[model samples]
Target: MKGVVILGESECSVKDFPDPVPDVGEVRVKMMATGICGSDLHLYHMDKQQAKKRGERIPGHEPCGIVDAVGNGVKKVKEGNRVTIGHWLGCGYCDQCAAGNIMWCEERRGYGGAIDGSHADYVIANERNCVLMPDSMSFIDGAFIACPGGTAYSSMKKLDVRIGDTVAVFGLGPVGLSGVILAKAMGGKVIGVDIIKERTELAKKLGADAVVNAKEDDPVKVIRDFTGGKGTPLAFEASGSAKGRTDIVSSLCRGGKAVFVGAGSSENVINPGQLIGSQLTLMGSFVIPLWMTWEMVDFISTQDITFEGAVTHRFSIDKASEAYRIFDEGKTGKVVFEWS
Candidate 1:
């Protein structure tokens, strides 16, 4: 088997490794597609010695593939089934796990972070982590649903966006762009904010009612103007930057709700006084819970939305290095590795 290994300072390579074998309650999936997430860029830019500490652990969590083999005790999933992995594994008996929010479990283990991930020819996952992919959904769509797309969906759900309500999305990266698409599908008017022109343009193409180039204009002002001076009823923060975080809070109307999903820096960028004054509701959303995976698939299917437009680049595993470099540039949409 071959897997990607990050060598720090924005470098990566594909290397040979022993094929993984599943244990009880596990299944091995032949990789069909995997997405390069914003979190993966953190590993790519690690210092040399720090990156070496990862030591051959593959770096991909967004995975969609076909079940190639199953181990003893695996009953619900069978070989030849197409599935998207849930990425986080938890102690089966924990209350959080029982509620399908495994990411909150005290003993949570994340694929691509704590264990060998899906940027390989084959990956081993717990049978419970495999969500069946419909025949109508492409592997790329399934892969997005595993992470970025799912994250956006969870945030939008938290915001409870409604028809005629304006949504201000503070970032135009993959997750933020997904917010644009999903918010539109849910009947909200979306205003995408980003410093990059290309990203703002992509957001417009993806159905955002308007876009704000933060580098050249004040996003909060633009959002307020667009909303007829009331600001937006909802906002989603996915830039993971201090300015973006701060601006989103200011861009929301009084009593408006906002959800933060992106992660990069730990800066205290919000003003508590503003929240108190406006009586706003702020929430943090991570990836979707295990139970929401099926719901997201159903929503995508029923809404007839396609995530393929957000995928700007695709590469084979052999070109892992090039893929990492391109994604590190931070100017494109989702970058994925696909297998025939």
Candidate 2:
């Protein structure tokens, strides 16, 4: 098998590695497509946060593929089945797992983060972490079942953005775009804001009623103005920017729910006073629950939801370095590594 590794700061390479095999309750997946997540880029450049936490990593979590082999006790799926690996790996026997929130397990882990991820020819996954998919779906689209869409679903579930409510998304990255689409699908009037003009336009294409280029204007004011001076009933901070968080708090209607879906640096700051005065419900959402991931996959499968825009760049297994460079430049969306 061949895989990529980030040895240290500015040091990454692709090399041959032993192929993974399924153990009891595990499955060996022949990785078909893997989306290059932001964490992957952060690890590639040895960003301070990931470097400090987990040095020299193989970072990737959004992987979709076919089950090449299944170990004993894997009753949910069998060989040759198409599937997407969930971002979180949790113990199935824990209380958290029993309650259907396996993502909260104390022993939770994720591919490409805590372990070798989909940036390879094959990866081993616990049965509980794999969601079987239909053969009709492409590997690239299946890959989204784990992250951008899953995260969006989780945030929406947490905030409970209902029909007829107004929602604002502060960011136009993949997750933000996913938020916009999900909000619209749920009957909310959706508005999207971002510093990048291209992403704003893309947001509109993804069902946002309006897209604000925050770099050229005040997003908070723009959202307020668009919402008839009342502010949105629900707002999501998906940019992982401190400024974006502030705008989410400011642009939310009194008592509105605000969901923070992006993973930002630990040093990020927000004004406690503003949140208190606004009476806003601040929520932090991470990976989606496995059940929610399945529901989201089913939801999108029903629509012609295109994952095309999100996949802005693609590279072969060997050009792993260039993949990180393009992602870090912020000129593309979900860059993916394709297996040849």
Candidate 3:
């Protein structure tokens, strides 16, 4: 098997590894497509020690593949099935898992850094974490839907996105773009904000009714202007920057709701006075719940939202280093690594 690894800061290598085998309750998936996410760049920029910890750990989380083998006690899927691997999995018996919130699992294993991830010819995954990919979806789109798509869907549902709602997305990355697509499909007028001109343009193409280039204009002012000065009813922060979170919270209508989906800095600047006086609802969104995962899949499939435009670049696994370089430059849209 050939897998990509992060060696150190600005250093990456694709090397050979032993073929992965399915353990009990697990399955061996023949990698078909893996999406390169913003989180993957965190590993690419790691220092000597973080890189050391990432040694031999294949660095991809959003993977879709064909199940080549299944282990004992597995029942959710079978061999020859196309599936999307969940990056995070908890003990199946945990109350959280039973309740469909795997993010709150007691023994949660986000299977990228500690456990070998999907940037390879093969990967071992817990059967509970594998969602059977619908035949209607392509492997490339299905790969990203596992994470960015699922996260966007979960947040939109939590924000109570609805018809006639002005929804603003504070970042134009993959997650932010996905947010625009879903919000529009659900009948909300979508506004996308991003510092990068290319990203904003891409957002507009995807589904955003309007896009604000934060570098050229004030996003808060532009968003409010578009919404007739009342501001948006729902907003999402996907930039993973404190400033982005500020824009999301500040650009809300009275009694509006905002969900911060990005993992920004430890501390962010938000006005408690505004939060209280405006009766605004602010909350953090995590991974998708099991029930919502199905909803998201169905919604995307039926709505014909492929997010294909967001996937602006593709690379074979051999060029993993180059792939990360372009992604870290932050100039492109979604990037995917294809194994087949």
Candidate 4:
């Protein structure tokens, strides 16, 4: 088996390793497609010493593939089944695990982070973590659902975006782009904000009603004026920057709701007074729960949503370094590695 390993300072390589075999209740998937997420870039940019700490761990979580083998206790997933493995693995008996919120489990292990991930030809996963892909969904679409798409779906569910509602999405990265697509499908008028022109343009192509170049205009004022001085009824923050976080809160109409899904910055950007004055409902969302992953698959299928439009680049695993380089530039939509 060959897997991609981060070599620090924006370098990566495909190295050979022994093929992974599944244990009880586990399954091994032959990777068909996987995505390079924003979180993966954090590992890609790590210093030499920091990267060394990762050892042989492969770094990718968004995976979609065919089941190649199953362990002794595996029942629901059989060899040859198409599936997308949820990135979080947890102790099976915990309440959180039972509810499919494996990421909240006390003993949770995340693929590509705490364990060897799916950036390889073969990756292992618990059977419970594998969600079957519909016949109509492409492997790349399934891969998106495993992470960014699912994250946006979770946030949208939290916001309960209604028809005709104005949704201001801060940050036009993959997750934010997914938000625009999903919000538009759910009938919200989307306003996308990003400092990069390329990203803002991509958002428009993906169905955003309007886009704001934050470097040229105040996003809050733009959103407010766009909404006729009321601001948006809903907002999603996926930039993970301090300014983005602050702007999202300020861009919402009074009594409106917003959900934060991006992770990176540590700055204190919230103003309690504003929250009190506007009577806003601010929530934070992580990746989708395992149960919701199945629901998301169904939602995409029933709504006829197409995520392929969000993908801008694709490469073979052998070109892992090049893939990471382009994605790190932060101008593209979504970068993926596909296998035939």
Between prediction 2 and prediction 3, which has the larger lDDT? 3
User: Which parts of model 1 are misplaced by more than 4 Å?
Assistant: none
**Each candidate's lDDT (Cα)?**
0.93, 0.80, 0.85, 0.93
Q: Kindly state the number of residue pairs that clash in model 4.
A: 0
Give lDDT tens digits, candidate 4, residues 1-340: 8899989988889999999989998999999999999999999999988999888799999999999999998989999999988999999889999999999999999999999998999999999899998888899889989999999999999999999999999989999999999999999999999999999999999999999999999999999999999988899999999999999999889998999988989998999999999999999999999999999999998888988999999999998989999999989999999999
Task: Tell me how far the alpha carbon of residue 207 in candidate 2 is from the true structure, in angstroms, after superposition.
Answer: 2.6
Error of 2 at 306 (Å): 3.5
C-alpha lDDT (0 to 100) for residue 295 of candidate 4 = 94
> Poorest 10 consecutive residues of model 2 by lDDT?
48-57
- Model 4: pairs clashing at backbone N, Cα or C within 3 Å: none
Error of 2 at 312 (Å): 1.1
For candidate 3, write residues 1-340 as lDDT tens digits. 8999888787799999989879899999998988888788788878989788656778888878999998889887799998887777777887888887877888877767668888898989988777776798888767867788888888998888879888999888888988988899889999999999889999988878999888889888998899899988899889888888888787899998998888858775888999999999998888687666666777777877787788888999999889888888888888888876
Candidate 1 lDDT, 26-68, residue by residue in tens = 9999999999998998899999999888898999999899999
Per-residue lDDT tens digits for candidate 2, residues 211-245, read: 88888889889888988898888988888888888
Q: How accurate locally is residue 135 in candidate 4, as Cα lDDT from 0 to 100? A: 85
Estimate candidate 2's alpha-carbon lDDT, on a 0 to 1 scale. Answer: 0.80
RMSD of 4: 0.9
Model 4, CA-based lDDT: 0.93
- State candidate 3's TM-score: 0.96
User: Cα miss at 192, model 4 (Å)?
Assistant: 0.2
- Candidate 4 TM-score over all chains jointly: 0.98
